[model samples]
Target chain A: MKPQSLLVPALVAAIALLVMTDPAMAYLDPGSGSYFFQLLLGAVLGCSFALKIYWRNLVSFGRRLFSKSRANRPSEQQDGPE
Target chain B: MTGINEVKGSFRDPAGRMFRRDGVLYRGIAPQGLDDYSMLMSSGLYEELCAAGKLIPHEEAASPQAPTDELRFIRPREIPFISYPYEWCFEQMRAAALLTLDVQQAALARGMCLKDASAYNVQFVGPRCVFIDTLSFARRQANVPWAAYGQFCRHFLAPLALMSMRDARLAALLRTHLDGVPLDLAAKLLPKRSRLKMGLLSHLHMHAYFVKKFSSGGAAASSKNTRTLPRNALEALVQSLRSAVLSLKSDESSGEWTDYYDNTSYDAAAMDQKIRIVADYLSSKAPAVVWDIGANTGRFSQVACEAGAYTVAFDIDHQAVQRNYLDALRSGRGNLLPLVCDATNPSPPLGWALAERDSLTARGPADAVLALALVHHLAIANNIPLESICDFFGDICRSALIIEFVPKDDPQVVRMLSMRADIFDSYTPERFESVFSRRFAIERSQRVGDGPRSIYLMTKR
Candidate 1:
């Protein structure tokens, strides 16, 4: 497998290890279901958040590329009759 | 700590206990809470929250002697009246839920997190909801999910969603389930279409499934199995929960009394006169705290509020209470609180030893009570005797009672009697005055405009 593909799994494993090792002191019982659900939701939301940021970046990059190409074109050619 | 009487409901948290010494409420923080207390004070979160009115303000009180078990004593400003979650209208409950979330977010920003999200921790001072439990905060630990996540879902999200989507009456479930409505029960009770919403599905439906799956035990026994939630992930989770809460809207369409003002027998002139009468009585009494029983949309309660009295407008109808609450919020009336309460069967004492939450009557005898256009419903519709109604008013009113006695000939009472037998021969104006006079001195009585109804100003004996 490619190193880039291994990165995600490695990060997940590291996070899981950290989660297991961290000691939590809570007076109220954080139910097993609630704890696990939060973890699952957190991961999903984190990924989506990252994806949203990247998506916006990608869109802006595409816009910049398209605008650069348009700018390269002759002004007279872009506007036929103004 | 020797003379102080610990608050019964405050025993759950080991870090501190709320106690009263010489009628002043103080929190005695244990040695276990020293670190967190210092962090809270040093981090400036306490000041920020108090300034924003999100938290109840407190001051360091002089301790006679620093006991070994006690770290510090803080005297918090007393809440005039304590009300429970079940008594709160839809908007009030929603406001409380949002306030809890906002406080949680603020705490997170200061490297702290709420250790518990019990609805009991949130108290309403008029229209604004404030967090009262100072010991609920703990220093945030990295790679751990919120300890109060399940509680938030149960205490706030589940009930709020149920009230918004299913039925407004479902909010009363909070009375029975002191911890909060069970997620599984909430999931089942919610409409099937609610599962279609991603927020509800993930937070409630799926969360319930996970809880049930792990209920048999051993699933959460080993810390090695716990999955990490990074700080950003935790923030994302809180944001998602906030979105979920925000997405659920309060249903203002339900309840019988939402449109009652428009359909009442009283004309505009009569209502105006009635308002003036109530205001006159309130001003004469000069009550600091007033409870407007059956305050539909809080029209007369507003008069009491305008007369410089902190008023609690209560109604059995959820929509009416919600409408009243919204009006209070819009008008920025900090002295007016609208609550949902059935006069017949009000909120009873609940929780551990049945002493944790005070019964409706236990919190009162308010300085005054405004029972306007409500006696007929209790006496005629509910078949409650005039004597009993008078006795009840005596029990709930400390000094003054400004109650309207709608006679049998009144249009509203006549309409009410249309649906039931007019067996209440004793439900007469003379009988009302006679019975109430047993417990109170009738100071003044005036007829409402040209109507047969009369508003009485009585002082409790």
Candidate 2:
């Protein structure tokens, strides 16, 4: 049998183990502490992802601010896509 | 303050609803949504996305129709054509996915997140997928798993993976399931080998597992009621999803209709003459908007555009539409839009109340329509009768139509007949003329390439 094909049982066991070892001693439901932790993790991860995405934009913005050649830019007669 | 017209498709996002007044589209920000809309407006993310041509830009409407009720009313730039995901080729769907991910990443950077990821919120303006829903953004919260992650997967990823792995026509599943194809369905339909692929395995297979386990009531919250996904993990998840989406390369162009142009009997000179003739007909009655049906690779769409008509190139083959879109990008032409559509079962009026999305004909009464080298396929292959075909064409175009008829002995038609028994006894040039002439006044007729086949330009009677 392929090792990859064994993940179904492995995953089921992992879930079973997590349920058995629950430290909270109560059914926490959807709003449980661990779920909150995951959400928090997601938010922080989102912040970092955003930062990584805008790094190039930040550098370009900095370059434009520092460059003398960018001093005189024409104002838009209309607002639209450049 | 009297007129109150809903934009029809904007009811989902409670933050703001798209409305219309005096024929102009306006977004009315609700009280609950005002704070987030205000945050987005001040954040400069909107300006940046617009500057990059990634987001559709809007302005405060000069005068509000409902001034007292609205917090901040603005008018959005009108999208020339609104096309749904089902109508998109594989490449277009892929492009929409990339754009959504980029928007999400950008939104996160600006301390905002996409509240939802619906392919319906996107509209194509000249080869670029621009997000149109102004209220899709909300202030980002700490430790929240991407709320729209599941939606993003369904709307963009599921259909894409299904299209790439299972069958290209499976993309049409978006049309039937207005909320996007369900994960369980996609997971089941995907091949056994797909389980080995990491991205597909985790996002699709594992995702389906969780959905079934938690949802099915058999295992009632197996582990914790909820699970924690850390920042790094969430990023990894998004990245993984992106990789899964990007990995699917469309292998569409080699379909049945793809090689139709190659097998054509028309020589270069004949092709040029046909284009000139079509262009001349288009110029005589310069249509405001033109629809080129069976526009394989959009060769005739370019002719319409060159002759100064905004063109919507509709082709059944995804690869052909993809190529047409790429050509539009390379040529920097704003007038042409390529869409995948099987003329017989063209995209129907779909979504809530059947009006959320416009049907193929709902977007039309095109000022002019070009139905070139398409009749034989509809008549012979698909078995649509000629009179019904004429009536369908009649329903879509108002001013003019340029259609071609390939004769029974023509190689393409003969090839179509070679497989099936010839039931079409009335498939004569004379019969064709008489049937169409009932609905359309023949403006002009010319035989293309010394063949029995002919092209006719008609005015709807």
Candidate 3:
């Protein structure tokens, strides 16, 4: 699935998790809002990044399978012509 | 501390404070900053950044009289003229933002992260932006989201988005918001279409939402949860921000004065003669620094730069400054800096106690000033008296002034007069020379070709 499709659900889940979590224990006040936002966004981006990697791997796997089938057919045609 | 004067703006970071002694700049690192300072040096980050020209190079100096609390002292190379973000055009600000990110990434590569991402930490030394605050880095902690994420968003991303999507003039907002434009305000001002941009959505709109949501609850609502961010995720987040910044492009349509040189009243021969005359004056004086006020697209400012003087080309029009900056970058003119400044109301001393940033005049006493074809606008258009103008120039330039006097009968002046009543009875060449004579002595005077306009090279009295 596309990253955009996963965004709303990820956002909702993060917000829910944020609501349930205890008050933050930050040493440096990067600003309460900014710190929280970074956490929430970091999770969403992480998921999307993982999905992108998986998607790339799946595409490469499919491409290899198709190329192997084509190569077998070319050899069979050569054997018939000989 | 006896002879050293602490730089006021440097006190914000307790890690170290920049001070000047005997007219040389130095950074005093307190005992608290020792660990980070040592790490910054030993981790090879310092050498890498210095070699890349991303950071200002400094040398450790022995100062026996250094403050008792200071553990070490290092002197940084001085920038010719210190310019604030408010004076920067859209492209210049964008360049600074990208440079900040680049430095942060480089720091993260070596188990370090920027402690703070303030725009003030970045400064332009010519056309290139360099991260000036050597003490801004800290050892990176595992599973901690970049601590300066919010600040980076506020200082760089917000203003850039507003400028690119809304209006270029919105950059002046930095002058008021010295810390950087508030994220909430930036979110409000941005066009609705910006919400469609994923980077803008997460970094700006949603970021502002969280800030407002948590602001009222204070520290109680602050992030108490220890959410772990994988190193890959953190890198991805920074990459996202970089993409956001890269996506922003300034409106480069020719501004009112961007094409000024092409449409000027002077013929080609007259323009050439004026260039030669200005070049002659600059070469003869050999001033170390030159300020070209009313430098429209920096035509004559180039002459000053080519003469081997560090030149600051200031113009009121944002487009003009933007064009001039791009040209400087393309030509690799390390001696030229183009900034937006309204001569009538130049940048004033700003920030805490009004000492954090230097005003235009406070930064100057430049070796020479080029006021070519500028007096009439100040005199006739702005209604500033010639004496006051002369006084202003005298206060800013130390040695020489190459100024042009446009007679009332000149086509440009005539056009300006046509729109408004010609009440400038004292705006004559004779009045100009007499009034200016109080501050400067006329060393040479030559008319541009046969035009009614005359250029004067004056020595300050």
Candidate 4:
């Protein structure tokens, strides 16, 4: 939503546009470097999408972790009979 | 069309071969495909995907055709109608692309991978696209890139880009290039500005460059270095591709018939009356599958679907089909599928030996066929003879036919004739029925209100 957030994508796409401008007649993309790049891109994108898909879980996990830590601190500060 | 008929498209994967006996579908699993399949079955991925309707379910047959060399024989649920990618509109193609990814992602979670992601492997379960090839799965290798990445780009990505970046009608290119629109051609045809998009830049344009630049004499030195891509990376790739495809949604073009129902000559009451008649005919003799040809915006097709029939709504107009598909998505109706098709030149069988995909006619013998308000375009505009039209219908519909004959004086038909001299003299309703009588016995006929269109319910002779 921020202008700054839009800047990175616009920049990356502009560069990609520059790189992809070549008029290459050879479209046989069977395991080419660009294909690898796409795989890498996919992996990154997939992870982010996955993160978004499970954002609720991620938030709950964070809350549970924080609550457990707070509970542990009180127990640690208050020594038991031992 | 029955008994041990081998499905031509099923042979490519050594994992299995598909065949039909009577009306049921049987899959013969190869030795190599057994372990992965068993793992998938045991891991509960197959059952889960099927439960979600993302995958087609199959069961092991009691009898195995070749028990020695094969793992087991299985029977898959037969698809109601088999439609090709070329026949799909942008929304359909995009949904299919996403479905393939969803299946792959689910497969990855269970330590399995799709050996191939060919669009041919995906088919319409109704409005939704699903993976049908039971044998496309394999155990995932550590740090291995998606082997079907390039295939995905071709079959799904390229055609989509062409449609999005250039024109929607370019989807027909899938007919000539069965393997998919050549990536190089897609790159060339794509507008210069498309390179600005990261997905298109990396996947298509740059891919074409590398393919041409490196694939020199099949012994390109750079081939060896294209090694093991981590699973994380593959997942990211799928995600990126999904967004890329999703963004291309706005590029669809609207056709004249996109808003057809809005401008139709029929008043609301007349339209309602015609719908009642069609629905009555469908309910009396309930059909499992219904094909509504020239279903502009699927208004009446919805009626067939409401009658609990699996309906395929075909229209030559892309925008109308897109709108129809959008409506299905919005309403969440799985019984209706909207496809872009020209009835005059129906989809012909293409691919390996012209057998991989079935022609529109081959996929049918539908339990019922609806030809509402479609005759005028065929007879007048397309110059198809009335008898030939009847013959085409007879070839496709096995049981029932609900067709409407628009009179010559109807505004739509008159508009069609206004362009040229009225050469279709035998296109009268009497002549139409007499010609159709050769193949069908008319069961009922009614003049749809005061309109010039007459609807007929006929049974095959």
- Model 1: colliding residue pairs: none
- RMSD to true structure for each model, in Å: 3.7, 12.6, 3.9, 7.9
TM-score of each: 0.94, 0.82, 0.93, 0.84
Q: Which ranges of candidate 4 are over 4 A from the true structure? A: A1-82, B1-3, B66-68, B217-222
- Candidate 1: stretches off by over 4 Å: A1-19, A74-82, B1-3, B64-68, B223-225
lDDT of 4 at B17: 82
Error of 1 at B320 (Å): 0.9
Local accuracy of candidate 2 as per-residue lDDT tens digits, A1-82: 6433433433332232223221222111222222333343344444545455456456766787877444543333233445
Q: Write the per-residue lDDT of candidate 2 for residues B56-84, one digit (tens) a residue.
A: 89887654753455678888899887889
Candidate 1 structure quality by residue, lDDT tens digits, B82-136: 9888988777887888899889889989999899999888898888889998888
Could you tell which candidate, 3 or 4, scores higher by TM-score?
A: 3
CA displacement after TM-score superposition, residue A70 of candidate 2 (Å)? 44
lDDT preference between candidates 2 and 4, better one: 4
Off by over 4 Å in 2: A1-82, B1-4, B216-233, B419-421
What's the ranking of the predictions by lDDT, best on top?
Answer: 3, 1, 4, 2
iRMSD for each candidate structure, in the order shown:
3.2, 9.8, 4.9, 10.4
Q: Is candidate 1 or candidate 4 better by DockQ?
A: 1
Model 1 residue A38 CA deviation in Å: 1.7
On DockQ, the leading prediction is 1
Runs in model 3 with CA error above 4 Å? A1-28, A78-82, B218-222
Model 3 Cα lDDT, one tens digit per residue, B117-187: 88888888888889999999887765566778888888889999998998888889999998888999999
